[model samples]
Target: MSKSYSHPYWLDVPALKGQAGQPPDGEICIIGSGLSGVSAAYWLLEKGFEDLILVDDQPEIAATFRNCGHILYGTVESMKALVALHGEEKAQKLWALSIDVCHEVRDTMQRLAIDAEYRQEGYLVMAIDAVEDREIKESIALLHKHGFDSAYVDQKELEKLGFRNVFGARFEPGSAQAHPTKFRNGLLQHCLKRGLKYYSGVSVKSVDEIQGKVRVQTERSEHWYEAAVIAANAYSPLLSRFFAEHHLVEPFRGQIICSEPLDEPIPVSIPHSFDHGYEYALRTADNRLMIGGWRNHTPHGEVGTYDIGVNPEVEQGLKDFVAKHYSFQKPLAWEHSWSGIMAASKTGFPFIGPTDSARIYTVAGYTGHGFSWAHGSAKILADVMNGDPIPPIVAEACNPRS
Candidate 1:
């Protein structure tokens, strides 16, 4: 079963069909068509790499397109929690990279002329529980210590933002939201124009590194390349043997539902969340409610591979949440229901860079914050492939041998 976004709301973009046969031999082979893979291809093209091939089994509608499109400058998990897990320096570096990537995403969209409803209206992390409120306060303090601007807002402030049931909230002004599928499709179209060859419906079975050449086998045929990138997100572990041992990239499925266009529009475009059960609502250009999140309640059930079909329990949970939190006056008709898989690491940061196998490189384990960090990770991987100096942060984050 495949995931599908609710329709009759946001702008529609045409899908890119997958390649029918084996990919043509190229200088570089990217094994996923998600934002990270596409972004890497786009940046590589910008750096003048002509021969590139991108492969994906579900290229037209992968997890990247399925995201709620929250371009956050911070982690969905609180900063204080990350600091406790990976220490202050590592946590701060992760947070800083996310911020950098947010800026990079804006620049890329602008340069490419991709109108994704891109905005920096800020992100609100609200708390529906006492534990979350405590975490929010600590997160505010942590952000201040790391030189990032964030404010701890009380219930009154949350009410002003049209959000209720907020024990407390932390606001980060640098975050953003956008129409995800349109943005990804726009990038794909741009890549095609720039000579980035894409092969959808083609899954790479195995990759073998032999004597300066990399051989990749798909269902139908095999192709060889000089370099390769495994940017398949949650689907990456299945292709890379290195990821199997050093990384624990657990896949968590998220369900999203959209409401029919309302008579009165939701005033803002920014996303809101409470108790880590993200409930983001953004108004489309035509004024419809596109909201997603609430997998926290059934975390065990949501953990698995990339299946787009909605779980009945998760779907009902989202419906109940929308009824309680959102402002669609009448019984909101569910236009669509879909699911996307996100990879999370035990340490709560992603692995990005060359693996033990020199020919294979990867960037996965976004932990639900891939949109924010993907661009920078792609840039770093491109630089590494080009034999340039890899940044220290990239080196730290790249746990090929973890």
Candidate 2:
């Protein structure tokens, strides 16, 4: 079933429509009620900023709803690669930023008493080839030197854990996973309770500076706010030309499939991935298997497109991945399949500060690690908007103009 729009396997929960149904009439307008936007509103409210408005095209099913439920601790690249790309200090700060956000999410859910089905079961980064095997070992060594508790596993141990055709793996004990839509719903409800004015099905056409205020022009009408934050992720370019002109974010579509709950579970206990995150699979809480990210094998590489329609070739690649990696008790019956777009950052880190327009800001370009970045990045955005000082390292790494 190849449709133009995505149909994720997550539950279809109703959008959180706050006290008002009309567009925002507040001092601060958050354009895009995805995890990023909701997180921004939460942080802003925490910073004593009231009268905030959150709007979304379809808040009921934001793009994060379509992501795998993994709460990863870093970007798709290994820690070693990160250090090589941005010196040791910057890489260390970047890694700490990810860890902070991940823990904040867990703490927030716990404090709010929201059962998001979050589990700190950690993650396994398996190596599909010799090169990655070596990379994993090196990355683990670097992580340990930096006081992280990651460990490297040999192929024999991997076989014991039921993974096949892999040389070695890196196990990060601090990582975790969750129920995507469940977590989003809980967070949204928490924000609403904190005086966040949320409106659903309100898509913004453009965010422009008008009369010393930010003009959020929607399809139906225009609403003005003292300031605005563009947290739309992959869709940011569609709303503002600055992002496209600067080539800040690129949209890449990813496909995923879910299998019927198995009577006898596969030997794998936690979420795992390989090939620089081109393929990943995990057993859900309900005993079903969900896998995604075979876009690497797709004909067009799944880039520069918003359509999340499932590609048959990429779907077949995922099935083949399953057949090659594991030996199931019975033939798997895939019951659901879907896809979604991810925003890859050209600057290697998400833009999380003021843009060219003083009245407008941004926190987009998470580069497929939104769950790990949104909350913490939103904190930085809030600080910047509040005239507070942000860490110099963060200022340089996530600079919007950079």
Candidate 3:
């Protein structure tokens, strides 16, 4: 199955130069061009770090571009599961940090003047079974305990929201939706204007800790920097061999399908599933039903895979799910379909900070919530690299020493 978004809905950004160039001595060298890397670049640019290099294997499209674009304040069911594994205090702190990240994304987008079609529409996690309904209710309670604004919606309310066969639902108003590719491209453009260097299609072959600086060897040329950041999503493992020993991150494939432009929009806001494997139906400005999520149907097949091709069963499942719940007047045709690999962490939190080597920093293992958390993670990472105080929320969730 070829993994790609099934629709032509992305806001295109210019292609970046991927061939290696002379390694200008820099304050920071980031090794990914996704939201996390670009967001870090944008924040550093704001802080007056002109010397930075952003590198990626696939410059144009990757996990960040293929995201469902839901800017959520907390993890789906996995967050509560983290509470079970790590304890309530740690889980609460993690959720609060995620909320902070969501706010940071909205503020950064506004500050950068990036019109990525952002919407404040809250995310609703709908349960279709009894056990899932109980889980949703428990999660809502945990959310409130952590000072988050959330409420459990009954079947009547769920039906009013155009959801059928839903046992229950939970609503979080702090969540949002956006066009991810456009947001990433906008940040990249801003980074370019701020004098940030980027090399696309260039994979970092090796990272060597030299004298006091980090030496990054690429397929084309060798570059050196005072500090290095690995924000390459699931692909980070390929570059940072130490990542394999940590057992903190794994790659999961997410597939999506888009319906042809409808006469009228189906969902005015973002609608996702309770199981954490599906999110869909954010109406495009042009009234298209852009939807994705069905990897649970083939969980074993999706793990550790980076291919961006379409899966027929997953695609058809999306179609059936949409038709069963939402009312569409016309016969829907899928315009585009694609898949991207998302990094899942064992702790259900992102790993961001300096590694064993003082020069090597990392920001990956977002656990499928990078859209909300990436910007804040980037900001804190840039600050840490510059010898500034790390944000408290970031400090708690991300401990490279852990």
lDDT of 1 by residue, 1-402 (tens): 123343313325655665676689988899888788888898788778889999888764467767777888877668888788678998898788888888888888898899888878887777887888998898899889989999988877666655555688888898888777667778878989888888877877877788889888887788899888888878777877777666658787877777666776463556766667466656666566677777767757577766767777877887887666554447676676777778887556677777777778777777777886777678877777778876776566545354
Candidate 2 per-residue C-alpha lDDT over 145-223 given as tens digits, one digit per residue, 9 for 90 to 100: 8877898888998888776798888888888888877777788887777778777778789988877988888888888
TM-score of each: 0.92, 0.95, 0.90
- The residue pairs in collision within model 2 are none
Among all windows of 10 consecutive residues in model 2, the one with the lowest summed lDDT is 11-20
lDDT of 3 at 106: 93
Which ten contiguous residues of candidate 3 have the minimum total lDDT? 1-10
Q: State the lDDT of candidate 3 residue by residue for 195-295, as single tens digits.
A: 88887667788776889988888877788788888888788777786676676589888887765667765644564654454655576666777777767
lDDT, candidate 3, at 121: 74
Task: Supply the TM-score for candidate 3.
Answer: 0.90
When 1 and 3 are scored with TM-score, the better candidate is 1
Better of 1 and 3 by lDDT: 1
lDDT of 3: 0.75
Most TM-score-accurate candidate: 2
